[model samples]
Target: MPEGYEDVCAEQAVVEGGLLGVKVGGEPVVLSRVGGQIYAIGGICTHKPASLEEGTIEGGSVRCPRHGGCFDIRTGEAVRPPATRAVPTYEVKVEGGRVLVGRRAG
Candidate 1:
């Protein structure tokens, strides 16, 4: 496990092509499973005050439900219009069926 990592939820909680919302280190984060991998990113959309948990998963990207802005789940990069800023990405690892989230990636 990496330093600053905290268990967020069970690895099974994040289904394939689905999104799960969780709080890590007192900060809101959204978890998604894509292509058998779990990714963690800031929960709120950069384009507006919207929860990424409510958004839909499109391939390797998450589409914000508020304005349809899309963000890459792997890199936290804004891949669509209405969102010019990238969301914060977090380090995630699965250990013993638990999903652990670490400090934000830079």
Candidate 2:
């Protein structure tokens, strides 16, 4: 719905307590729906080169499958061991049943 936002998938694709991996602007991004809200973050684990889509949704965080690293889906902050770098976060919005992903968040 805004500039730099690209349609990634249907809103239903990101189910509650689940993770959806997609590419936005040629960058890997993971979309998650928690507590009825949608969030976008770098799809790769900061500690390793693992796809976060293969990870599990633990509450409001995404746990890397390769390791036990965790990152806050809302802020992209590393919250667990093995990961000390923060992943990039993106802007997300739902419109017309579609999930749109925008530029990296600050």
Segments of candidate 1 deviating more than 4 angstroms? none
Candidate 2 Cα errors over 4 Å, as ranges: none
| TM-scores of all candidate predictions against the true structure | 0.96, 0.96
CA lDDT, candidate 2, residue 21: 90
Expressed as tens digits, the lDDT of each residue in 1-106 for candidate 1 is 6679999999989999999999998988999999899999999999988999999999999999999999999999999989999999999989999999999993
lDDT of 2 by residue, 1-106 (tens): 7788999999989899999999998989999999999999999987989999999998899999998899999999999989998999999989999999999994
The per-model lDDT (C-alpha) reads 0.94, 0.93
Error of 1 at 79 (Å): 0.4
